[model samples]
Target: MEDRKDSELKTFCSRNILIILGFSSIMAVIALIAVGLTQNKPLPENVKYGIVLDAGSSHTSLYIYKWPAEKENDTGVVHQIEECKVKGPGISQYAQKLNDIGTYLTECMERARQVIPESKHEETPVYLGATAGMRLLSIENEQLADRVLTMVTESLSRYHFDFQGARIISGQEEGAYGWITINYLLGKFTQKLTWLYLKPNGGDVQETYGALDLGGASTQITFVPQDKHIESPNNALHFRLYGKDYSVYTHSFLCYGKDQALRQKLAKDIQAFSAYYYVMNFLNFTSEEPPSQEKMIDTMEKFCSRPWEQMKIYFGDVKEKYLREYCFSGAYILSLLLSGYHFTADSWKNIHFMGKIQGSNVGWTLGYMLNLTNMIPAEEPLSKPLSHSTYVFLMVLFSLILVTAVIIGLFIFHKPSYFWKDMV
Candidate 1:
């Protein structure tokens, strides 16, 4: 009689355990549904946190923006960006030493964490984008890129930080997004400068506008002439780089970036000089007559054993269009020429110094930063040039968490041992 009772008790305990497991599973499913539904819960009137990270071939950069007041009509955005740090061997190539690359990224993020105020960073949405050097590598190289990305992401995870978004996009996407940022700023400058430059009497300014952006491995020429008030997306800015089938308005060239010249061959012969020489050339201009081709060529041969400085000398007029010197480098100057316009050094209006790079002086005079989202039509939402956008990333995050929870619950319902296995 005692043995039978003990066996009955054991059976009762297992049955009770199964019943409890079944109930817990129902609760878990309901919980996941709650998390997913929260996505469409409608964001508050204003988002308090925002961040952006641009990891390029030569450097890594971060920008943080916050909406100060939460009113729908109260569009007040306060933001700060940490200084960019040098991180060579971008994503594409950095994969070789995956661990080292991750460290480079960590250093950048940690530095930002220090600079950003302690109060606001807890929930900042950090967006990171890696380009060129990382995008162009082979499959194995890309895997290395992924491995490093995962590491840096996990490292950032410790701080309750979320990747607002991160992706590896294409050159075209980059060009477009940059143009969007710049062109949005252009709105602030339009009527102000264009009005000022408007040839007094009549008969148009007899000229068009263009931009030259020289990055690590590529140079772009963007131009759009305004014959009559400039049309769609017009504040009259264009991007000539990374567009397909170009029999057209702008021009651009690849493998022509200043940094790239250091690795591969270049037409001009500054082979021996450091990258800063080019920087110095742009920044340090004096009343001193420009160097002679012969002298410049001699300098090159003596330096790179080629007629390097001479080319710069020969192209003196166009190269000089870059007024700020170092800010706009060689690639920018090259694109300046590709504008294929009759631009003397005089044509450079010093856009960087111009009150508003775009739009109305209202944005500039008011001393406010305009988000690309605000100034441009929110439609067609221009995005980073990659398959993974912020929406995509979040969708993935939600999907993963949901899938994982479901798997756990399913295992538990069918076999209680799964609970321990999942935990382990």
Candidate 2:
């Protein structure tokens, strides 16, 4: 009778112990899940702002850029948030009326004041960079260029933001920065080469695209050439980006921009063709599938042969001054690319005329801002192997799995002897 009583007591205790263990395992899993969820909550983002004024030959434009303060060193972190084109011609054109510089820049500066948060105003740095137009003016009259830049600097100083200086950037600087902008926007700088190694003639890694920038007063071409040896050291630029070194070939042709080339064509007494036809509209030149060199010449020839009166009727909306210049601009662009730059018929397909990339205008301004701010570090920043959320999720998943295994083992151990025998 004592043996029976002891056996009952032992069985009751064993069952109660299994129940306690199972309950504890479930509670542990719940606690782990709650802790993980609480720990994985996102933190607030800290952002920074910058401003660049591209005082181009034809016009002046203001660009506001922003990035996460923590990720400033990362490639492509900075991006244009706002673009305000300053009213009136290029700041260089304001040489005669230097006093009006401040007033002229007011509208755009006001727009900037409205766009950026007031708290960030004092911290945001503002910069102005004049391109070829000012460069030409400076060449003709150095004192006058200096005066113009002085006025521009003074004008920007009135704003609430931190004013960086204003100056005319060299053509070489222009070309190199343009190359950096495109490559950065395209994500070429930080691209991984793991999958590219398997392909034959893939050249061990991804190659960067060449930059062809055409503006009103100058044009620039920059690229990484297959041959490392550059004959013209003057045209060579070296950069260390994302821990990789690059030897880039870049050249800027002053007075070769579309507008300047058109003037040159007119000065040479090139015959003015039919009036009022927008060349892009008539030739379909700006389409996704651009026309071949031969197709372009053939189309231009047929279009230019038409009488002025007939062309006017077809394109009444276009102004007479611009209509007369279209043919020459088109032909000049072709000549500049083929003769001036030495691009071949086969290689012409590689050239891409892009106005913007990834919502930001492709230009030297962003690169210039990046350089001055030291936003892009020489060495890459360190990062965690796994994101916080991922780590937390994995921990929870594994804990649940462990708890399940323990429960299963406890259940089997507590089973009756007959349960195992039936399975066998």
Candidate 3:
């Protein structure tokens, strides 16, 4: 009778302990789920929009950019949301027919209106920056340039956006901005603390890639030189970005763009083909793995030496005008890069001919907008103490550990006989 009574007591205690442990485990799991659900909720995005119209020599392009309002000062935060190419020629071309400029910009403005929310339209700042074409026009006729800008500003003001005024940007500004755009997109400006030792001399500064921009009316080369002393003060631009000071060397050559260069070459040399990009593309010249100078010359000579009538038969789809200037255009590009820019064969490998970077067109327009709006802060923004994921993970891990500890403590207190049995 005593043995049976003891057995019943043991069974009762074991059952009660199991019930408590099960209940505690379920409660812990419930708490963990609640914590995860509460902590991991997504926050609403507060976004801002801006518009930039890049009025180039050959054409005009409208870019709509958007970013998180809180991250406006962060590098690579601004991105192109929409790109609209104006159907007509560049605004500079409408200098004589100034009245038509409004109509020309209407379609793009309407598109911008459709893309952005109606509530944000009034707050969105619109900017127009005319490049080399306008610069040349301004040089030849300052009054005409002024009139063109006035007409452009008036046209843009008709929209609901906050018009920031339109003006011709200097070549130096163009070069510097292009460099900024490239380096910014490349994420060279912001360096993490972990990467400090990787840099030469164990310095915190990051190496920046040089920018080579080729446009319709001009070409710009900008980079931070190895030597601290710059010979030409006019070509040097100093910038303080993300808590780092940069002294950059930049130069923009007017009429050195493929189109203008082709015209100059055609006037002086024999013109057999007219298309600049089309011809080079046909020869596969515009690629990351470009041919050596000797090979490029050889290829061009062979292609240009082909009989004109046979060429017409083979490539009849191409325009006669563009078909005749291939050789001269090719030679001019090589000479301009090699001789004019002084890029030797050894340094030439580093040059990357990119039309776009990270889905945005590589140009001075993005950089121009960044400067005007003060998007790039002079100092680095403070980072958060803990990321949401890391916080969540730590909370879950600690909760698990606490639950395990409680379970072990309960097991030891209730089932001390098991431990004694194991030891024996």
**Candidate that scores best on lDDT:** 3
Off by over 4 Å in 2: 1-40, 72-76, 192-205, 264-283, 373-424
Task: List, residue by residue over 1-424, the lDDT tens digit for candidate 2.
Answer: 9978866865675567667667767777776766666555565456778998888877788899986665422433577889887777887788999999979999999999999999989988888888888988999999999999998888889889988789888888888888877776776655442222222232333687787776677788888898777789999988755445778898888987665766632322110111111244445766656667778778878877878888888879966766667667667666777887888878876655555666787788876665554543333333444577777776777687657757664665667344345654
Residues 42-152, model 1: lDDT tens digits? 544433555556655555555555444332222233333334444554545555565665466666677667765666577555666665555645333656667767765
- Where does model 1 exceed 4 Å of error? 1-49, 66-81, 84-89, 138-142, 180-209, 223-252, 264-424
User: Candidate 3 lDDT, tens digit per residue, 139-238?
Assistant: 9999999999998888899889988889888778888887877776776665442222232332566788888766667878888888777899999998
lDDT, residue 110, candidate 3: 97
Query: Which ten residues in a row are the worst by lDDT in model 3?
Result: 265-274
Clashes of each: 16, 0, 9
Query: Candidate 3 versus the native: TM-score?
Result: 0.72
Compute each candidate's TM-score over C-alphas: 0.46, 0.72, 0.72
